[model samples]
Target: MIGIRSVVFDVGETLLDDTREWMAWADWLGVPSHTMSALVGAVVAQGRDNADALRLIRPGLDVAAERRAREAAGRGEQISEADLYPDVRPALAELRRRGLWVGIAGNQTARAAELLRALALPVDAVATSGEWSVAKPAPEFFARLIEWAPGAPEEIVYVGDHPANDIHPAKVAGLRAVLLRRGPLGYLAAEDPAATAAADWRVDSLADLPGLLSPR
Candidate 1:
């Protein structure tokens, strides 16, 4: 029960819904949307990396170049404000109103920051794995997030939907972890009796977040 001072969020499926983006990627890969969807589910079920799942769809695909092509065609990889959860803005606003710094830290691609910035979400900081040179489930990434927060790890709460990447690693980094029930891995984590207990907090939606993190 460390007094919480800041909240860091995972971008995809937590704050922003990427279902359309995934579907778009499926189209770009010349695969059926259902097929891509199933692959995503399988990846989560097997505890596999998402990149591996994409490679299964299109081996030797140049992911970066593909993204650039999409952008050039006006189908940028960034999530729009329309894709964001209904609860996201209010929750973030509440946190800032309560004097808590807010940020987004996730294992997103290079354009993540640009996309998030486009949404004009109320946050103090935004960062992606590509920018940090490290991805989640890694101590170094959390270290960078802590530095970005400019807050003591004990006083920060990392909110995300991934059990392995967000909850466990943030806990190991000495930040309180809050499991948000949205995204591919969220239900998967709940199905595991042990994994469900790993988080310091759990909420069904970001709307429930403000009350949970009120200074104790």
Candidate 2:
């Protein structure tokens, strides 16, 4: 196997827990927290987009428009160091210490990119789909990611929780993929024979990554 020279991460549910992000949406939508959670779970199981949960609660709702309105109301999104997974800092720091280029790329808003940078994670780069003008599951997005990557596609490992968005696409892009079974979508994906089979490796925690990528 080719030695891994870089490790890139997906944002939601991978590095960040995102519990508060969804709960804040529940507050803005005036929906009960349990109801919001259930809807999100439903969408995840159904392989629906994350915004589908909101559309189920409010049909014809423009997610972006509502986000602007929410910000105007002083109920905007916020992410911080506290939102990070317990293993995030240590994992990224370890990877970098091992002389691996570390980066974070995911389908998120510009504000999310700013918040992530503010967290001061030991990453070489941080980018979002919103900033890239493309998103996962699209060939163009991976093209852009590869453009931003430090090494050849074969030497970069893309780590993420979602199978469709992270695992399959990165593999298709010629980069190795590591499936992290966490989050609602992640656990659901862990049940899939195909998803596990497609990944270069399947792991439950980011902490396992350093050892897995370490040279034998």
Q: Across residues 70-164, which tens digit of lDDT does each residue of candidate 1 receive? A: 88998777577789899999999988988888999899876878878777788988889988889988999998888788568888999998888
**Residue-wise lDDT of candidate 2 within 152-205, one digit each (tens)?**
898889999899999999999999999999999889889999899999999988
* lDDT, model 2, position 88: 94
Q: Which candidate is the best by TM-score?
A: 2
Candidate 1 residues lying further than 4 Å off, grouped into runs, are 72-74
Residue 79 lDDT (model 2): 93
Q: Please provide TM-scores, in order, for all candidate models, with all chains considered together.
A: 0.93, 0.97
Give the range of the ten consecutive residues with the poorest summed lDDT in model 2: 207-216
- The segments of candidate 2 whose C-alpha lies over 4 angstroms from its true place after superposition are none
